[model samples]
Structures are given as structure tokens and as C-alpha cells.
Target: MRSSAVWRALPRGDLLLTSWPWRSLAYLITGVLLGEVVLLTFLATLFTGAILATVLVGIPLLLALALGGIPVAALERRRLMIIDPEPVENPHRRPERPGAREWLLLRVREQATWRELAYLVLLVVLLWPVELLAVVFGLGAPMSMILTPVLRAQTGDVRVLKFWLVTSDAEAFAALAVGAVWLALALYPLTLLAAAHGTLARAFLAPRESETGQRLAEITRSRTRLVEAFEAERRRIERDLHDGAQQRLVALTMTLGMAKLTEGAETAELVGRAHEQAKLALAEIRDLIRGIHPQILTDRGLPAAVADLADRSPIPAEVSVALPRRLPEAVEYVAYFVVSEALANVAKHSGATRAAVTGRLDGDLLVMEISDDGVGGADPSTGTGLAGLADRVSVVNGKLMISSPVGRFTLLRVEIPCAPTDHSK
Candidate 1:
């Protein structure tokens, strides 16, 4: 908020008393200096590169001349922060590799490079002169007039700058009064001019207009990476529980069974109880492994997995899936889980005795819908797990829609863009 533009902060008052006028003056002075430097350097580079073209030694120089705007624009962006407190964003993308060749290749192809070059040309030919004129007319002339009494006191009734002749104390004081008024009025226009220059600089030097799209793309890729890592970790946990803990529990159960057979009646009941406990723990571990990731989903694909879910649900359910081939692994995983969560919601809250699931591959999108007839008023916002399901779907750029009205049917639909991995019939 403190970094808002100078013009925006103008309404806060103390215009003449504040540091803004001084800051504007400084901005103009620097602009003139930078404009001269850019003009001379670019002219020399272009003319020299043109003169030595037949020898082929000037090719690199020509290329360097084209990229000269990059540094000029960078310096101007820094300079702009003097008048406009908001920092300008550099639009250039980083190179894929660490070499100069990679940097130039990327810069040359970018639209920001050309826009910056155009700004540099305007700076040299047009903008700096306008800035200089505004400063001279707006500040210089008024200050000169305000010094009329001082000038008249030093010289006897003399002409000031050969423009206004001040003959006496009254005339000199009158000229000073006019100058004071002019300076007061001039400061506002001067500040506005400086602010306008800053706006122009920012338009060219800042980030491209597509910044929102760029950020969304970055977030999407980041979420995809996180999803992949999460899936891998789930598999790792499942593998560890199956290979390590489940094996030990199995051996414990077998030992307890043998002891029950060989020991006397007194020890037999104790052995049997221990064996039962081991069996229960083993079953719980197996269920945890299934919950983490089902083997059927991996082996038989999404359709068979959904059918398995239907069979396991407490309520009777119907499922229809028509995929000629297997979808991408991530797509299938998200789709399967969405169905699983929706059905769980149906069983727990919908109070419906029956539910239906339908799925199909529609072009590049895999569409699935789960519906139930119940006293339905499901709100995803009320911690019904639909909110988390929506987030999971968005990880793969998918969409989830819920149509649940009070005292009616609840329908959950999801669509994700994906293609079948194996096309062989």
C-alpha cells in the first residue's frame, strides 16, 4: 500500500511541502542524462556495425546493438522507481541453460525485447526533450521571476532578464507576488508530467500482460509435481506395511497356531487368543494397504475398480463404464477416487438405498457422474469431503460439479482431459 504511485498519493496533500517536487526534478534530470547516453551509444554501435559489414566481423556487434535496449530498459526501470514508488517488473524469462547463447536465444524470441527497444527509441527521440522542457518552463521561469526583488536591489531599477523592468520597490514586490502565484500553479503540472512519464516507462519496462496466465501455469505444474510425490509416498507406505509388518504378523499367527495344537488345554485357550489378535492386526494392516492404494485399481484398471467399490458399498449401486482402453495413470487414479468418495458420501449421508455411476470417454475428456435419490442437501462447504475432492480433481486440470438440492437427488459430475495410454485393440 505504501508503494502506490506518487499521483495516487497526491490526494494526501502537502504537495509543495512534500519531497515529491524534488523527486520529480531528480527524475527529469536523470532522464535527460540517460537519454543522451542511449542515443550516442546506439548510434555508434549501429554506424560502426554497418561500416564493417563486408568483413563479417561486425555481425556480433549488430546483434549486440539489437540487444542494447535490454540494459537501457533495465536502467530506466530502476530510474522510474524514483518518481513512482511501485517497483517495475522485468518481463524477460530466464534462460533454460547457463550460457550466454541460451540467454540471447530467449531474449531475441521474446516480445518484451522488442517492446523495450521501442521504448528506448522513444526515450531518445521524444520523451527526454519533453521532460526537459517541462522542467525548464514549469520550474526555472517561475523561480527566476520570484527573485525579482533580489535582482532589483542589487541593480538600480533594472530590467530582469530583459523581460520585466522593475523601477521601484512596489514594482519589484509586485513582480515577486506574481512569481509566487505562478510557482504555486506550476508545481502541480510539473508533478503530473513526471507522473505521466513514469506511467509510460512502466508500460514498456514492466512484466507482460499475460502475467496471470503465466502464474496459473506455474501453479498447475507445481500442483502436478506435488500430486506425483504424494502418490509415490502412498505407494512406499503401502509396500512397507505389506512387506515388513504384515509378514511378521503372519509368522506370529503361525507360531501361535502351532503352540495351540501342541500345548495342554490350559495353554490352548491363551494361544488361540494370541493367534486371533495377530490375525486381527494382520487384517487391519491389509485394509490400510487397500485404503492407501488398491491392487485391483492398478491391475484391472478403473472400470473393474469401480465395480469392486460398488460391491463393497453398504448401499446397492449400479455402475456403467465404457472405456475401450486404459486411461493415463494419474487420470484413472483421480477418477477412481472421486467415485469412491462420492459413494461414501451417498452411503453416509444421502440416506438413499440405491445409487448409480456412469462414465465414458468423451473426446479428450473423461466424464463421470454419480447420482443418488435421497433427501439430498449436500453442501461441499460443510466438510462433506467434496471440497477436498474438488481440489484433487483440479490437480489434473479437472472439474467437479455438484447438483444437490434440498429434498431431491444428489448428482456429482467430474470431467478431466485425458487420452487412453494403450490404443491397441
Candidate 2:
């Protein structure tokens, strides 16, 4: 695949390239130099132990112990930064609920854990030699040419590294300089690759530190804000009732009571008018309360809640809630509001005689679907009531999708996350 396409497709592939060693032999020369650097120090340590065996074995063992923990934490942070960043919560977080050592062990057995370990082991072996070769490639390459003519003044000419392989000396400064310059330049990429390997190795070995406490605090703050917002809405409803409709209804009842106390033709006429006004006021009060929070929802749960809504709807509504039991309150609430609004829309606008409300739990989601076989032209752009419902669902991390193609069935589907186990409990 094209590199541009790969990065664009997902963050993980980008992370793999930016972090992991080049997964190809095309990176071989550079990687080998890096690999050699890492392995050499430890091998030397191990070798020294054969001579002074204790020093050799003990040194690498101690070195491993000291630096082993650093790499893993760094790698995890790097991977996270490359991928989802802030919106994605840290997956390294352990389950918030309490569990056992066995569960922890099982978690440690996952693929990412082993891959990180492999990266760390590779780093330890390459750390020293890669660093050394890189220094040689970077500086030695430049130095050989820069000093060749000048150095020839000092030694007349120095011999090549012919102790074993070359078995011959360079005649002039150019000859000795050329070999050294070429060797060093050739290894430059490998030197850089070694440094990269060492860095990645240490990073992958370190355990990822958890921000569980911080994240839980954030969750608590968010939940608190949600709770406060809900309460504020309730307060607004209470105020509306106390100052507006409630006062009007009380005044209407008083007028009717006074009218009933009179005993005349005028009194009878006044009482009838007052009675009509009182009834209107009462209906307004009922509608207001339903607007605030439907009592059917709290008392009977979602199925009966939706059924009551259907029963009162202006349009004939067929309600189907085959969920044998109640769903989680959060899920049920979103579903209830969605279905209620949908039915209200049908009654107010959809000229069709019939509508249907379907509620059920599908896997981890609570799905409430309302459809009307009416003149269907629900365009979300025109600021339909469904648009508000969609935004409300988003607040709860739910999804609302509406499909009301012209002259087709108008369907409003609200899916809210309420995992089965959560609702089951």
C-alpha cells in the first residue's frame, strides 16, 4: 500500500512504523549495525565472565536489572500519543472493578505485552555496539577525509587495517583515507538504526504507568455535571408549574367554586363557563408534567411507558416492547424520550392514521424504533424535532438515526448503550 494511504487509514500502522524496527531486510545493513551494537556490550560482559567469569556474568545481569523497567513505559506512552491521543482513554488501564491475580496474569499474557518484551530484549543486546558504530559512522567518515592529507604529514602515511584481512598497507594518504571514509559512510544508516533500536528496546521494557485515579476523577466530574444538569431541568419544570400553569389552574378552580355557590340563572351560566376553563387548565397541567418527565416512564418502566404514550397519541399507535424485562434506567430513559417524541410528531404532523413503536435490547444497545406509514419528508437539516433528539442522544454517547425519505415510511431509530449485563443486574 502507498505510505500516504497507510497513515491515512489508521493510527496503528503509523505507530508501528514510527516505533518498531523496520520490518524488512532493506533496513538490514543499518539494523545489523544497530543489532551488533546492542549485542556486543552484553557479549563482552558475558565474555569477560568467562575470563573473570564472575565479572562477565555479573555485569550484564546488573545492567539488565537496572535499565529493564525504563523502556516499556516510554513505548506505551509513545504508542498512545501516536494513535488516538486524548479522546481514546488509555487502554493500559486495569478494570476499575476488583478482580484477582489470575485475571491479572491473563491480561499479561496478551500479544502487546509479549511484543513489548521482545523489543526490550532486543534493545538490551544492541545498546552498546549500535551506539559505538553510530559514533564511528557519523564522525569517523568525516574525520578520515578531513585529516588524511594532514595526517600523512605526521606518519608519512599510516597503514590500513590489514592486520588480518587486508595483509597490506596503503601507499599514499588517498589510499588509506578512501577505505576508511567509505567504510564509515556505508555504516551511517546502520548506526542510526542501532540508536533507534536501543531507544525502542528500553521504552518497551518499562511498565506503562496508570492514570486510573485521574481518569476516574474525570468520570466522576462528568457524572456530577450530568446529574446537576438533570436537576436544573427538574427545577425549571417545577418553576413553570408553580408560577405559570399551577396558578392559572388554581384561579380557574376558585372561579368555578364561587360560581357554584350562587343560585340563579346568571350563576348557572357563569359556573358552566368557569367549568370549561378549569378543564382546559387541567389538561394543560397534565401536558406540562408529561413534558417535564412522564410519570408512566418512572412508574411502569419503558414498555408500559411507551404503551401509555401510544394510548394517548392522536394517531393510532401499535406498541411492541418484547423486552421481557426492564432495561437499565439510562437506556430506558433515552428510548422513552425518543419514542415519545416520535409519536408526538406523528400525531401532530404525520397525516397517517397509524404509527408503531418498537423497543428491545440488542446486545449492548437499547434500541427504540418508531415508524409511521405517513407522508415521509423528515429532513434533519430543516430543524425537525428529531434533530434535537439526535443531539440529546449524543450527550449520552448514544446514536439517533432517522430515515424518512419522501412518501416512504418515516423511521426514527434511537440506539443507546446499555449493556445487557448492566441492565440485567
Candidate 3:
């Protein structure tokens, strides 16, 4: 009878404890530690912000570093998906050359910055209070212990302020029971647990309106980078022309002029050298144009595009191409680039007997896979190759996955949403 009465009068936690008797210990530990975990998470964000600020300097470096957060913020969102047990959506992608200065400047200048900032701000707001409380809860009790002696003496009597409700010696003893609800602010442990859960949900679980904006921003940024890459490549080609073909042409023209001043075997040799230089210059020009846009791709679409690729490989390429008619230009362009880059990686890195490129249109997606049976250990983090592929996929609102374990085949897969027909039209 006493045990039952004791249980009944116990704080609500006793009922909860009995229900999860097996997990009660674990729950207590987690509950007590919750606030500390929240505190650490908030500190991590502040640390990241500080790190970015400290590392960034000047206009270019600062802009570049700030834009770098787009990817990290996107990663943070993905982490939330797994931890929050909610759907993980796409992450933010910003231009390699995103505009703006401070967050306020960038928020007005670039939507992606605003989106990324909103996510960070919301996450911090959600975390800071929880973290602060958790820190307070975890530490406050001990701090309170230090003050208890002083508080006791100041009162002159051990008077319980409203704790007088425990009129009976038994009730007062019960209320002050060690490790029980009647003990010092015993309600706090439960409050701390709920706060921790809410903090985790806010920081890592819940997807927000900003996630959608981030996805759009990533696409926009990737597109801008790709265009910038194209321009940069063009500039490189122009530089090569000025240095190689242009110089060669000038030398060839000068040699022909010199040949006119002589008429012997040496003059004949001079004309031959000029002719050879002209051929070399022509070859360089072809290579430069190919870099701009493989003319075959523009003329005959992807099959011929990849065929030109396969035909040139030192190691033979087995190519398989399929499509459901044609796709929207946006999807097709990304699909082509993904295949091109994947093949380039295979040719450069993969020690394969043979390679294959496959393309097919599935539902509203243009799915393409390029594979090579090679000495493999392909990781996304290993190089800029897969990162570039990811950016390409991002630009087209697509996904890219790479699988390569040691001694297995390396496969690069790309999927981009495509429409066979436009509804708005």
C-alpha cells in the first residue's frame, strides 16, 4: 500500500519511467544530456560563421568564401533530412562568382544568399535558445548548488517559498526527495528534453520554404558557373591561338617570304616547313573549335556526339544510345556534358579494357550512365571531376551518383528532368 501510494504521489515522470522501465536509465541520461547537446550544436554554427569571416579577406576571396556556404548550407539541409527524419530536399548551389558583399548586401543582390541566410538564421534562432537553456540546465544546477549555502543563510531560516504547500513532514520530505520530482526544480529535466527535441527538429530535421529557394539558387549558380567556364575556355582558346597558331601562321608567312629570297634545296625546305606549320595551325584551330562545341553534337545530336567521342579513344569504346524521341534543350545539354565529362574521366583515369556510354529517356527524365571496368575506387570527394558533374546535374535540376569501389567498375550516372512537350506553349 505504501509503495502504490509512493508511486501515485510521485511526479508524472514516475509513470513515464515505469512505462519504459527497460529504457528508463537511457532516457534519464539522454534527457539530462539533451541541453548540452543543443548548446554544442549552436556553438558549432557560431564557430563556422567565425571561421568563414576569419579566413575570408579582400573582395574576391571574401565573395568566394561566402558563396562557398551555399554548398555547406545545402549539406546542412541534407543532414537535417536524415536526422530530422523528414524528406531531404536538394541543397543550395551558388555561382563560383556569386555577387554581393555582406549578408545584407548579398540578400539584396542575390536571392541565393538570402535563401542560404534564411536557413542559417532560422536554424540559429531555433538552436541558440535551446542550446543556451541546455547549457544553463546542465550548468545551472551546479551553480545553484554553489549559491544554496548563501541562499540558505540569507533567509535566516530554511523557509520554502510556496514550498510550504508541503505542510506535512512526510509531504515536505517527499517533495525534497533526492532524484525525485519533489527535488530541486525536478521539472527541468523533462523541459530540457522537449527543448532538445525541438532544437534538433529546427536545426536538422524540418525542411523549410528556404530549401526550395536554395534548390533554385543552386541551379542558377551552376548555370552561371558553366557559362563562366565556357567563357574562360574561350579565353583560353584565344590565348592558345595567339601563342601557338597565330605565331605559327606569322612564322609560316615569314618563311614563305624568305623562301622567295632563295631558290635552292634550302628554299624548298623552307616552303615545306611553312606548309607543315600551316597544317599544324589548322589542326590547332580544329581542336579549339571542338572545345567550343563539338560541331558533330550540334549537327547530329547526342549519338553522333558520343560517337565522335568513342571513335577518338585510344582504348575502344562500346557505345549504346537510346532516347524517347528528343528532350527539352536544357535537359539534353546537361545530359551531353555529363556524358562527355564522364568519358573524359574514364579515358584519363580508368585503366579499362573497354568503356561504354548509355543514354535513355525515362518518363520525364533523361537518364544517362557511363561505365568502365577499371581499377576503381571512384569517390565523389577525390577530385573536381565528380564535383563538376554534380554542378552540371544541379544546373539541370538533376542528380548525379558515382559508384566505384576498388577492383570494381566505375559508373557515373546522371538524371535530369525533361519534358517531351511544353505545356505552357
Candidate 4:
């Protein structure tokens, strides 16, 4: 169905009239050029890196060589557009942090990176040379024979393919006819070769079926975590309402009933007590609502909300959040809870005098760090909120990192993507 589908176009009667042959020719030609450059670069870098390995100066060059396939594969994928209309998706995953080190570590660990290296090696050592030969024999030989008449006319006689000699105009014209037929037939094979090459490139460059399945599994796990977190949160809210505000409301009702059944000074005292109970119940309900989703977060965004959290923390907590713009509501919501839960942990478990919450936008990531000068042997397995925090973060495709030395400090760092996510998934 694709207009650029070379395999489909090969069987058509108008194959020669279409642009498929020219496109295939261009693709193969460019591939040969690219392969030559890759070969030279690979050899030079390998030799230099090997010579300088003792001094460690070539370590980076060697690393670059290892990662060289990434760029080569990217260019080849683009070149494939000449014959393959289907786009090849890059199989690399985004690094959790914004750094060259993190990016390099992630790339080296991915199977896609190694596959690309294999593809590059095959392309330079085998594929390009074969393509060069195909182009030369399939296209060049026929064109040369077709030009035999012109050569004979220019001089006295011409040799077709350096074998058959053509002296008279009739012999030259006969060679030309044969050459035309050969050229016409050769195009089909050439186009098919290009299509085969594209398929190989795609197999190496695009995400494999297994990788796609793994990604789907990861998404399913993250979604399940999100669902479990939501359920736990709902239960917490229910518990808080039942044990705090509902109990207070019931007491307030009882106090009012007692006041109505009494008289005079007793009545006034009971009414006054009932009014205080009613106010306490209202305050408890408001606190519960705020705990669920703070009004300040919805109104003024993350900075204001975090600053409010700092003000409310039992310890002297410093807040420094500077965002370029308001983030997606879900991101802000998750960020707020991460800070809230982190601060609560600090207050309850850290035994620290002070804590700080800092946030900034590192490229497209929202990087947040909560640090405290506490006796820090914080363990996620110790029934603390760190595991819950990690689960919550994973729901938004974010990362949670914790650093806590036995007697040092605890630092909770979270990196979340700034892009909006479909949480419904």
C-alpha cells in the first residue's frame, strides 16, 4: 500500500517509469559513502586508542568509538527513508539524569546500542562492498555497453565489456539493444537488494519485539503500582475522616443535645462547649481536605505550595523552588506529596534540627532534593515512606534516589519529566 514500497513496485509493469530505481540507487550509493567514512574513522580511532591506552588519554576516544554506532545508525535510519517509507523508531531509553556520564552509562547497558555496533561492523565490512559491486555491474556494465555505438562512431571501433569487439554501425547498434534489455532487467534485482538492505538496517536500528514486550510489562507494573497507591491513599483519607472529624462531629452533636436539655448557666456553658467542638470538627475536616489536595497548590503552583509546607514543618525547613513555568497539574500534585511525605519522615524519624527542599528545572526534568542534617541511617525497607515515594514516582515515569550514610545526612532526590503523562493509562 505504501507508495515507496520497493517490493510492491518491482512487479509492476511501470517499474522503470517510477522513481524506485533512482531512489534505490541513491540509497545504495549514499550507504557506500557512509560505510567508507565509518571504516576509516573506526580504524583510526581503534589504532590511536590502542596506542594510547597505557596513558589513559585515549579512554574517551575508545568510549566514543564504542558509542560511534549510535550516530551511524541514526544517519542510516534517515537514509532508509529513500526506499522505506516506514520510519525506524530509535530504541534508546532516556537517561534518568541530565549528564553525559548518565547518558553514556545508560547507552552502554542497552542491547540496542550493541545491536547498532554489530550493524555498523557488518555494513562497513560486508554490505557496502557488496552494494558497490551490485551498482557497478548492474548499472555501470549495461550503461557502458549501451555507449559502445557512440564510442565506435567517435573512433574506428569499440569493445563491449572489454570482450566483444564492434567495428561496423550494425554491430554497435546490436550491442546497444542488448545493453538496453540487460539494464532494464538489472533494475529489478538492484531495487530488491536495496529493499533487503533497508530491512536489515531496520531490524538492527528499531526496537525489537522482545524490547517492546519488556516495555509493555514495565508499563503494566507501573500502572499497577499507581492503582495500589491510589487505593492506599483512599483508605488513609477514609480512616482520617472516621477517626478524626467524624468522631468530633458526633461529640459536637451530643454536646448540643445536652445543652438543649439543660437550663440557665449550665445551658450557656454547654452551648459554648458545643460551639468550640463544632469549630474543632470544622478545622479537622479542613485539615483532612488539605492533606488530600491542598488548595494552595491548585491556586499558586509548586513554589508557593512547597513554601507553605516549609512553614508548617515542625523543624526549621528552608524552601527554594524556581520553575520556568507552571508544570503539568499531575507533576505538581505528585511533587507536592513527595515533599509532604519526605518532610513528615524527616520530622518523625530523622531527629534533625533543620531540613531543606530545593527544586529546579534541569532541561526538561524537574529535579527536587530534600536534605536534612539528621542521624541518617534511613532504610526504605524499615517500613518508612521511601518505598511508597518510589512507587508514586514510578507512576509518572520519574525516579527516586536516596542517600543516607550511617551518621551523616539523608538526601532524597527525585527527577521527574516535565512533559504531561496520561495517568489514566
Candidate 5:
């Protein structure tokens, strides 16, 4: 049912009855018109730019000539829909930042822009002329022969397609009958040629697979940056609470304790109560700050961070992380969280008495494993939060593997690619 069905419909008997032939004609005709306009514009611009090159006034004109393919390719893609119903995706990437300068710079650097320029040059110099010839010989000659009888009737003689002389009524009628058959057969090749042209246009105009991969990589890098920024903001908030609010609470608790020593029994009891509340609030804020971002991790890096996580776990846990140097901040951050989440899962679900966290560097990779002697059947699908951990690891292009068979042990392993940042302090 689609216009692109022309290829399949060609061998069918009912092709002439379908809209494909008319659509093919439209495609070729428009191509010729567009080609003429492009040719004229290119010539005029090239001549003017060359003449004014010495005055430096021709630079913008030359730039416009180079970028002219963008609009032409866009229009050609739209016109391609006459015989191709499937839409062609625009291959150009958006500028990293908004503005004409950024857009122009990006476009000039992209391979797609140059490819489009090549297509425009081919369209004007080559493809359009072939399309024009197809229309003329495939449709024009047959129609002229078919109209022979009408021409002979008005003038008493006619030249059929300038090839055959129709001097009698019988001759003119014979040409008309033959022309009808010729036109019917000509439509088949006409539709085929149009489809071929559409295929060529798509090949030139659509984004290549490598370009798509590059765009995907760009997106991943952008996501990584956002994640790093978010982690930085978390650290900032934690620092502010620890340095600003927590210190104020500590000073207030000290003052309350001093007041309790000097006051009468009733006043001293009230001061003691106030001092206890201040201490409790201070403890809660410390826990909150740790949860937001561990200051220990910032100071001592990943090994210390993992050790701290093991220390804070409810179950008995041991840590052994040996690295030659510090890792990148983002990799360290993701690794720390992965270990934290894994230990939490172990504590909450694993019926284990003891757990161990071990880490080592395998070349450029940071490999960490947390294992426990527990009844273990961990399924990410069971809402155990392992899926979230997997997502977090993937943000840094890391892998997470789990081995938790029933009644054996649970082992959570994560490997992240990273180069050493600095020698371990």
C-alpha cells in the first residue's frame, strides 16, 4: 500500500492502474526543475565569489555556496516521499551550544555536510540529466505517438514522434494503437528507474551506522558528566552541613554542659536535657552527612572508602583493597556506591555471619568483589536493588556480575575501566 511498494508492484499486472507511475513522473519532473535552479544558483555564486575574491567580499558568498547543499538535500528528501513513503532521518547533529557560530562550526566539521555537498554536485551535473532523459523517452515519445490521430485529423498529415510519417487516416490510427501498447510497457521501467534514484538519495542523505555510534558515544559522555556534577553537588552539601551546622550544634552542646555545672538543681536538670537533645541532633546530622557523601572517601580515596563501608556494616565484614594509585573521581564514586549497595543487600537479605570485601587493580580496570558465606539466591528481578546497582555501574562503563546459588554463597563482582590518577598516599 505504500508508495515504496512500487518495486514490488512492478511485476504485478495492475501496476498501470496504481498511482505509482504518476508518482514516478512527478518525482522525475521535480528533480529536473530543482536541478536547473541549483545549476543557475551555483554558477552565479561561483562567478561572483571569484570576481570579488581580491576585495574579501566574496568570502561569505563562497561559504554560502558550500552550505547550499543542506537546504537542497532537505528538499530532495521531502520530494523523495513521492515514490518513497518511508521518511529519511536528518543526519545532521545539533550544535553543542546554541548560536549561529557554533552551528556553522559544527556543520563544517561533520562528514554529513560534505557528503550532502557531494550529492548536490552529482544531482546538478549527472543524476538530473538522466532523470530528464527517462521522462522524455519513457513517457514523452509514447504520448506524442498516441496523439498522432488528432494531429493528422487537423492537418491531414502528421509526423509520429518525428520518426514515422502518418499521411493517411489508417496510418495515424495504427500509430495510436501501437503507442498505447508502448506507453503501457514504458511505465514499468519508468517506475523502476525512479525507485533506483530514491535508493541513491537515501544512501547519500541518511546517517551512516558509524555516525549513529558516534552520537550514542556523545550521549554517554554527556550522561557521565551530569552524574559527576551531581556527585560534586552532593559533596558540597555534605561539606556545608559538616563545617557549618554540625560545628554550631557542637558549640551549643558544650555551652549547655557548662551551664548545667553552675545552675541550681531545677535549672541544671533542664540544661542536661537540652545538652542530650543537642548531642542526639548532632549524631543524626553526622549520619546524614555520611549518607550524602562520605568525607573519608574524599580524603583517602576508594580503598579507605570501601574499608569505611565494611566497618559500618551491621554484620562482621573484612576489607582488603590494594591499589597502586588513586583512581579517577567518577570511577571511585561509582565503585564506592556499588560496594555500599552490595554490602547493604548482604546485611538485609543474606543470612550470613561474616562477609569480606576485596579489591585489586587488573591493569586499567578496578576489580572489586564482595562475598559472604550466606544462604544466597540473589535475583535482580526480585527488587533486591541489584538492578539499581547495575545501572550505577553502567554509567561509568563498568560491569557487575553476581553469583548467588541457593544455600551456597553470594558474590558480587564489579569491574570498572580506569587509569590510575596519582600514587597512593
Candidate 6:
């Protein structure tokens, strides 16, 4: 993997042959040009807006000037890619809704907006000119000297950068050799300066450390919401199937059974078959409801749910969960499914005679492990089921670890950080 910073990407002892030095020079040159433009535009708009403030015409102009850094910083970010291949994330958060008022309000309120403005001010007043000078002296002078031989041949007598006269080919070639040496030495500082400039831009323009953390927190919260929503929808479907379809199927089965008992010998067999089909349909619906979101898991929590799974597993399974109380619904749901799937995998593939599931709340973490004594090689890549389970665990900021060495026991472990629910509730 490539390092995000260009300085880190630079190969040691190969400055001349690599593209980094050229990229640095280009980055500096562009910064200089961009800075000059920003400075001129800034002054023009700022003073004009100030002068016209009383007239009401300048109000919009001032607002524009205030938010001007957004576009400027956006350009800078794009330019930053030249020297720093690392992505510079914009610190600004999206508005909750799309509207000019919301956008401007959010921008004005955000610390990132003000930070960008400060960066623009710094760039206009100080940084860009410094970069300009460095590029001119560091890269420009050496390049000019390297062209010494060409200049002397063209003019027969040429003043080298107006510093010295070079009339002879020998003198020009000597200057060329010196310039080559100078260029090699100059590239180091050039790269360093560009790297520094990129770092400075990043400091003000990129998201702050706290902001990054906040974004991560927001993402976690949003993911949790999505998971909650998904679970609720599943439960809704389960309720519909259990109450509506299952009730109708049960009534049909009872009616057919009664018909079989009451009917003559000619119709008895037909009614019996119809009654059996209704019962099967009713059973299947119940299974579908359980698969969607088991009511037992909801009512009795994880311990009982694991026990239920153990009782149903084709392979002999033991459950030992030491939770004294219920956990959050999402946590219980995820844990239950992980154990259920692990046992299913064991029964189907592991040839395991016995499987054990253990769960306990250790500190804030809900820890669950499933182990099977069988020929063991569990690879999530071979099937989507395990991969999907892993994703489900991650949605709650949990981790899934699978240790299934070939010809050994397969152990699947999961840890989720959450405060246990108050059983009193």
C-alpha cells in the first residue's frame, strides 16, 4: 500500500529519477498562482463589500466573501493531491436538507468553515509567496544554470542569470556541470518545502481530530439506527405471518380434521390428506416467523434463545450463557443468530458430534463463543452465510473471530460492547 504522504512515498537515494520532485515543484507553482488569484479576489470583494455594507447591496457580497473559502479550499484540496496523494477529507458536514438557507447556515456555523477561511487568509498573506520564492530560487535558478551551454551557443557570449559572463564552451559546460550538481541538491529542499506546505494546508483545511471522531460516532449511531429499523421490519413481518397466515392455516387444519372425523369412508382419506397439508403449511409459517425474529428471543432474551437453538440443533449441543439480565435487543438478536448459524454450519459441514455455545457479559462486552469438535475448516469466503453474519456483528461495533484450523475444532467467537439492560425495566 502506498503511504498517504508524498514525502513518505519518496524513494531513498533516488530523488533525481523519481517523479516526486517534479510533483512537488508543480504543486508549489500552482499554489503560487492560486494564492495570487485568491489574494486579488479577496481584496476586491472584501473592500467593496465593506464600503457598500450600508446600502444593503453589500450584505450578500459579504456573505459570499465569508463563504469564499469553501470553493478556494476545494481547489486547494484538489491541488493537494499533486504532492499528498492522501485524500484530504472535507471537514464540513452535509446539511440535513437541501436548501440555500440550510447550506449557508450550516456553513457559517461549522468550525470547518471558519478554519478554511483562516487558511485562505494565511495563504493569501504569507504561504503562497514563500512557496513562490522557494520554487524560483530552488528549482528555477538551477534549471537556468543547466541551460548554460545552450545560452552560450546561441549568443556566443552570455551572462549567466546576469551574474557572470560565459563566452567559452568550457566555461558553459563547467556551469552546466555545477548546475547539475545544484539541481540534485536543490530537489531535497524543494520536496521538503512542498511537503510542509501540504501539511499546513491539511492542518486547517482537513477535518479536525475531534471532527473525525464525531463523524465516526455519527456513523456508528446511524448504523445502529439502520439495524434497529431492519430488526423492527423483520419483527413486523414475523407478527403478520404468525398472527394472520398461521391462524388461518390452523383453522383450516382443524376444520379438515373435523371433516375427516365426520365424513363417510369415501371422503375420509381426502379430508385426512387436506388436514395433513394444512398442518404442514401452518408449521412452515411458524418456522418462517421464527427465522424472521423469534418471539422467544424477544420475550426471554439470549440465554433462553440459545437453549432453544441447542434443543433444535441436529447435532448434540450444549449452551451455557451467564448473563444475569437481558441485553439490548440488537445485541441479543445478533448473538442468537451467530450461535444458530454456527451450530447449523457444524451439523452440515463439520461432521461434529457435539457443539457447545458459551456466552457471558465480561465488563461491557457481550462475549459469545461456539465451538465444535469436528474436522474443522470454516472459511466465510466459501459461503455468503458466514460473511453476512460477520457484517451483522460489525453493524453494532462488534467483532467476529473464527478459528477453524484444518483437522481441528472450529471455534467462532464474537464480542460486542454494550451496557446490559436493566432487568428492572
Residues 252-284, candidate 5, lDDT per residue (tens digit)?
777676775676786776676677767766777
lDDT of 6 by residue, 1-425 (tens): 22246767555786678889889889989999999999999989988998899998988898898788899999998898998777888788765433577678989889989888888889998999898889888878888889989987787887887888897899999889988898888888888888888888888888888999998996776576557657876887778777767776777777676776675774676676676767777777777779878999988888998999999999999889988677888888889888987888898899899999999989889999999999987887787256667767877878777777899988888889878566523
Error of 6 at 396 (Å): 17
| Off by more than 4 A, model 2 | 1-244, 247-284, 420-425
Per-residue alpha-carbon lDDT of model 3 for 1-425, expressed as tens digits? 01122223235555444432222223333433543454465466456656667655233443443454355455554443222334444333333221233333534465555555554544445544554555455434434443444455465333343233333445434334432332234334533343344344344323356766665686687677778777877789889999988998999999999999998898999999999999998998888788667777766677777777788877678888876465666666677777777778887788888888888877777778888998887765677477767876776668777767799888777778877666212
> Which regions of candidate 4 are displaced past 4 Å?
1-41, 70-111, 126-195, 206-220, 349-353, 375-382, 403-407, 419-425
lDDT, candidates in the order shown: 0.81, 0.59, 0.60, 0.88, 0.84, 0.83
The regions of model 3 sitting more than 4 angstroms off are 1-235, 263-269, 328-330, 421-425
**Which parts of model 6 are misplaced by more than 4 Å?**
1-4, 7-11, 50-54, 152-156, 251-425
Clashing pairs in 4: none
Clashes per candidate, residues 3 or more apart or on different chains = 0, 20, 5, 0, 0, 0
The candidate, 4 or 5, that scores higher on lDDT is: 4
Q: Worst 10-residue stretch by lDDT in candidate 1?
A: 93-102
Per-residue alpha-carbon lDDT of model 2 for 1-425, expressed as tens digits?
12232233333434333432232112334344544654565466555645663655565465443343234434434433322222222234332222455345544654445655466565555543564555555545545654555556666544333331222234444555675666444443543453344345334443343444554675676566557667867898888888877777777778777877887987888777777877777877887878867888777788888898888888999999878666777667777777877888887777778999887778767778899999988775665566566656766777776777688778887778875554453
Per-residue alpha-carbon lDDT of candidate 1 for residues 1-425, written as tens digits (9 for 90 to 100): 22256777566567888888778788888898888888898889889988887799878888887788899999988888898766787787654223476678889888889999899899989988887788777777777778888887887786755687789999888888887898788778777777878888887887765854685685686577557657866887878777767776776777676775675775776676676767777777777767767889888889999999999999899999888778888998999999998999999999998999999989979999999998888986687877677768877878787878899989888989995566322
Q: Which candidate model has the greater TM-score, 3 or 6?
A: 6
Q: Top TM-score: which candidate number?
A: 4
| 1-425 per-residue lDDT for model 4 (tens digits) | 23248878888999899999989999988988998899999999999998898899988888788788899999988898999888887788765444577788999999999999999999989999999999899989999989988888898788888899898999988999998999999988998899889878887898988888877896787677678878988999999989999999899899999988999999999999988998998999989889989999988899999999999999899999998688889889999999999999999999999999999989879999999999999987797878778778877879888888888989999999986445311
Candidate 1 regions off by >4 Å?
Answer: 1-4, 9-14, 147-159, 165-177, 230-425
Per-residue error for 296 in candidate 6, Å, reads 34
Rank the candidate models, highest TM-score first: 4, 6, 5, 1, 3, 2
| Candidate 5 all-Cα RMSD | 20.6
Task: Give lDDT for model 5.
Answer: 0.84
TM-score of 5: 0.51
